[model samples]
Target: MDNIAGTKSSLVWAVNIAVVVLVLLWTIPTFGLLVSSFRDRDQIATTGWWSSLFPHEASLRFRIGDAETQRQEGEVFVIDGSVFEAGGTVSAFGTSNRDPAAHEPGEVVDFGDGISGTVNEDGSYRVTSPVAFEGRSPRLFVTSVTPPRFTLENYDRVLFAQGLGRAFLNTMTVTIPATVIPILVAAFAAYALAWMEFPGRSLLIASVVGLLVVPLQLALIPLLQLHNAIGIGKDYLGIWLAHSAFGLPLAIYLLRNYMVGLPREIIESARVDGATDFQIFLKIILPLSFPALASFAIFQFLWTWNDLLIATVFLGNTQDQLVMTGVLRELLGSRGGDWEILAASAFVSISVPLVVFFAMQKYLVRGLLAGSVK
Candidate 1:
């Protein structure tokens, strides 16, 4: 008994540690993406997401007001301004990009030819020359420890400038009907296969099961040709039909298996009460199949929502029809270096699926377990 107890305790600790490791593995990258989305471009480029949560030392180079804005002060040409708009402490400053932060703030540095500049700790700067300043405004570089900063500008740019907002709506336009139409058709087919006897029923079930192993990519070209031949070329309707057709096999298999597990006595009792097959399905099977329906709905919804290949092949990549995945792919090609935009766009694209999963997860688990056990 003592040895058994010790073994159980060791097993429990091992399981708990494994769970912690798994959770961290899944969560860390997602957390980083979420944090990066709210950051500005410079911050994202300069530091990792974890470092953005704390005050950190950073360096920046900028130019003072142009020479055109200079004033004659006491026989000297002068340009004066604050380097930071919202006011920040400056630790060091420099006039040349090659040696940024070369001089401590408050130290006046003389540039040969009678040009001198001073940057105060408060980020205010003044440049003076006995002769008129020429060429352009002198550059200033500062290194300072800055407070944590974040912005929604990335989201703003992705949604409006990069066209992700329109893509989001386009994805919805494809996903909603694609998810709903197939469930309705699959539910009726599943009911017939499960309860209402018909010829070649077993063969049909076997065919659906076989289709589960068939690769969708294999049929892409053939299906595209078929759609085009039937005058449904490269449109929302065409994509919807493609998604529904691709989704149906699994949807029917799940629903039929779940329906087969329902208490046959209930279906039989309803049938004897002068209730037709459709009536029995509507009044009895539909309500009891809620878990299964929710499960397949969530599955089809997610699959359609995140689909890229089908959308790309069936729908044209126009601004009006491009989905979020296509927009993300475009961003990857065009804005590959823009991590903030990519992170924000990815978060926006995934938000709906996360909500749907969390909302229907309980039903999905219940349906899977019920179907598996019976």
Candidate 2:
């Protein structure tokens, strides 16, 4: 009964649970990255994104008032001021680095010879000495608990100082043409294979499938040499052609599969009406194949947009031509230790792909129609 039609399988529940788990697995890191992008380096280093909403305790070193800030109060020279100029609560403090939290706030430490210092919970500090203060005031290490803070400075620095703005436009330049040209060319090829009779059609389809498994790394150097020979050396045109070539096989395979699945009656009736192949394709086939086209568009857009190797090989890595991935690679090398900047740059790079995916996701499953119909 469990295997019968209109009955549920025991594994269905397990599959649903697995899918929810997978979605959360992917979403959690992305959410963390978004949170981290808005934070400064210090907070990110000290705490995780989940802790960003609460106060964070950190041990910090601050210099007390220097000799110039000291004033004579009766017979005693005194230095009085808050260690934090803006905000922070001192929970504990010490005058030596070895025991930074040796004393609680509001407790005084007597250093002998009539020298004493005290720090209060409100970050205020006072030091009194019988002798005049000298250069280089005392170093105070305090444990402070600060309220949560967020900022847009990370985005500002990444988009402007890191050159991501220019790289963004360059990636758009490469990806848009790379995606469209392949889809247009593959649409024609797919229509011919699906409907129009032609010699060697089976061989061509077989070749397309064969190319799908072939790794692109095998052709990078050879393709670069070919680009140079054709006088298209190291330009957007060359990279566009490279992406289109690599993407075409999959594009044609998918569109052909979906086009072949369309009801045969429509094509036969169009042919009987004296319609040419181009007319059948433009008027009849293209409109019906929108799901497949959109599906391929999403794939090619994401692949070309995220591509680093092809862009590096065909488009020279000049600042004028660097893509988003290359610019991010440069950032990773130069600012590898700055997690905030890296998080911001990474989020910016994936923003467009996320939008494109969600926008066309409905068509994605519809286009995977291979062998669905006899």
- RMSD values, in order shown: 4.0, 4.0
Per-model TM-score versus the true fold: 0.82, 0.84
Measured by C-alpha RMSD in angstroms, how accurate is candidate 2? 4.0
What is each predicted model's overall lDDT from 0 to 1? Answer: 0.89, 0.89
**lDDT (tens digit, per residue) of candidate 2 on 35-119:** 9999988778878988887887889898888899999999999999998865878889998899999999999997566789899
lDDT of 1 by residue, 55-160 (tens): 7777878888888989999899999988887556888888788888789889999876888989999888898999998887677889976777888888899899
lDDT of 1: 0.89
Q: After superposition, how far is residue 44 of candidate 2 from its true place, in Å?
A: 3.6
**Which pairs of residues collide in model 1?**
none
